[model samples]
Target: MLQALTILSLLFLTDFTMAASEDPAELGAGLQNPGYEELPAWFKTSFLDLTEDVAEAAAEDKRVLLYFYQDGCPYCAKLLRDNFTDREIVELTRQGFDVIAINLWGDREVTGLDGKTTTEKKLATLLGVQFTPTLLFLDEAGKVVLRLNGYLPPHRFAAALRYVAERHERTGERFSEFYVRTNPREAEGDLHQEAGFLAPPLRLGDNRRKSPRPLVVMLEQPVCRECDELHQDVLRREAVALSLAAFDAAIVDVFSREPLQTPDGRETTGRDWAAELGIEYTPSLVFYDTQGREVFRTEGYLKAFHVQGALDYVATGAYRWQPSFQRYLSARREALAERGIQIDIMR
Candidate 1:
């Protein structure tokens, strides 16, 4: 449906930088690799100011992976659907890089390595990204040390993670030279939009003004498969879906600079608000009560049951008394079980 679209967030101790094409139809045409808005939860919430991003990542003892792709690229789809879905690969990348997605064909403003503002398409050209799913691994100084021209299978992708994570380049181990020789896993999941999610052109200001329930702000990117899974596999399920209905949901871009009224009655851009809150990861769930005060927040990947519990915690006002979320969840499960309701944490 989106004929005109551009670039996309969940960050780990997460942050993101972007102006994106947020349309699923255009994100990958038939491929299903959406933009950064659907990206997984581990990516750091960043300003897209590469210099600041590099400094922040280094402060956190993390490196950076500047991922370049465009709409309708099959290899890009494979990278998200296959490589990133691998648990080991996800965890390995999580332990190492703060991944940022950049659209090779987008026109969104990007703050370049030289502290100059440019569009995504221009920057991609500057980086010489001739293919979809090009990955530029940057060191602490924001300098590219390794560049993978196109998609690498899961095994090689795993090796890439290790190569960068362990500083293998310092040992003179080339990526192609040290490639992990093993069978690759096939990709999984149908790339579809998260149904029942708060639809886009998110009018978050209106949400705060109209709803009396707590606010649930989902900081996401289009390329986030985990975010996709949360909707496709988890949030759309019966119980969790109902649980989420209690809040006024709004999906926000981590990299957006557009100003809006926040839940706490402050006027700020999403990027500035995210920075102010020190958001570290993608697909985060930040909750606010009727008074616009933040009551609770979940900053990274969480299973269905926990996500539901987090929602319930705020909805039921459990956070007011039970400071320990773990304790509250334990008591919740016990109470549910006593009533003959069994909770499936994963499903």
Candidate 2:
């Protein structure tokens, strides 16, 4: 009897240990931490001081490029492997900018351009870095001349490099103008119309005040493959479709002259408004509150999970309380985990 009782106790202890050993991240959204990538040797090694770095780069007749990334990020890995590996791109980047990498969830001390000290993670939060591999191209004054929210394909990435490196910003030409002029590509057909999107003559000024729903203006171009992919694939997902039900979406061709009233009650054409907003990337989704205030925006290639998260982030009014979209996503993963729902972000 004593021997049998000891064996039962051992079995219970083993089961408890096994349960405790399970990864907590798996219980939530399947946010896999892709292992770290070895940064290029030519990448600038710094003490993470933004002011000094900007000054030093300016002294060399170069700009500052802030690369925000996280461990195990596939897109980040792609940017390094695809864009950085190109000889022309590497040479242009090395000659024109001082690149500094900041981990999205790192603990290293960072002295910001504002001369305030913070952790790398906090600095990311302050900059509102919602996605991995968000790159900020800064002018000599440390102003973000251009900000790429997500990964851009090689052609567009190279165009962006030239736009800044060639001092197009000083010429008063928008990056969008430079990109379209320099790197025109044959894209798929017209805007993919959805039943959920509000038909044109979009008086967003009226819609915001009258309806309780938020506004999502999709700034796209006729010649954009990414826009085509977004409409054909990402929008067709069930989760993304469900989230669209919560907002009044408007699809506007960034180059079109369609007359529309802006959210701030200004009468303008779609093209003018898009230029005014600095909508550089095609298929940029700009979200606005019922009060006509801009809430959140996403301007690069994104999968279904992230698209849905962006929709839900503004739709649920979560942006009011949670300033950091990354933190909000973390909380969302935790909440979904509690309900036994696992999400694959890359899916």
Candidate 3:
């Protein structure tokens, strides 16, 4: 009985040891010990005193490279271990940036410009920090020059840092222009292909003297996968493109920093206006009259044919008589087919 009990205890111990070894968080924490001598000289393993360091760096006209991370953040650990330790990234960052790492959920006290000391968690909350591994390039005055969220591989991270640094050196050019020039991949028709279809110039806004025609306003978020897919697949199709061009079309970024005036005459930020419109997801299409009054709204992804049918229903005001939008679209397509107008309604 004693021999059998000893064998079972050994098996339990072996299983526990193997489980701990395989856990990424546990392995990362073990490797991140403060006394670990393997860290490169350029990389500081210590927590940064952001209050003093950031202020000093800003006063010197040096860009502040602020990395916000949290304990048990797998992406943050990877960024620190791989990206921050890359030879090229370390060298470039040393030249132009004062790098600092702050714990997102840490209890460390940080002194503000107003001389008030606040915890790191409070500061993160105040700054709207939601994701781990957030990188911020800040100007001397503490204004954000560029903000990047999530994990990036070493090469991409280095390139992004260099792009921000070059933009900072340019005195006359705006960050947007500099970014496009420095990182052509982020320019229109490249990494940001969807930006091309967001033709705001075609929309009726306060700048217009007269309403050109009825409009369809598409409220979208930049990072929304559904929005990207819709733009790439359905909106880019030839039939849908031709159909959409018939009306005054506009695309509004819900997360834009600019202020927008709603149809109800309430002035709010673009983000707030989108929330007020009850848009909880991407690819929300809202049809409006020439006066910007909401006529109908559709949320979620739609295929090219369905989008075309919806546009027809809204354009002809057939939605009033139809019991449902989907039913209206079906009847509209059949009616158009009977009139010998061939429309591709597949996929």
What TM-score do all the candidates reach, one by one? 0.53, 0.49, 0.43
Ranking the candidates on TM-score from highest down gives 1, 2, 3
Worst 10 residues of 2 by lDDT: 18-27
List all candidate RMSDs to the true structure. 12.6, 24.0, 21.3
Candidate 3 lDDT, 1-29, residue by residue in tens: 99999999999867654542232334565
Candidate 1 global CA lDDT score: 0.74
How do the candidates rank by lDDT, highest first? 2, 1, 3
Candidate with better TM-score, 1 vs 2: 1
Model 2: runs farther than 4 Å from truth? 1-186
Instruction: Output the number of the TM-score-best candidate.
Output: 1
Candidate 2 on 7-73: residue-level lDDT in tens?
A: 9999986765444333334436753333455577788999999999999999999999999987667
lDDT (Cα atoms) of all candidates against the true structure: 0.74, 0.83, 0.64
Error of 1 at 140 (Å): 18
The CA lDDT at 154 in model 1 is 68
**What is the Cα-based TM-score of model 2?**
0.49
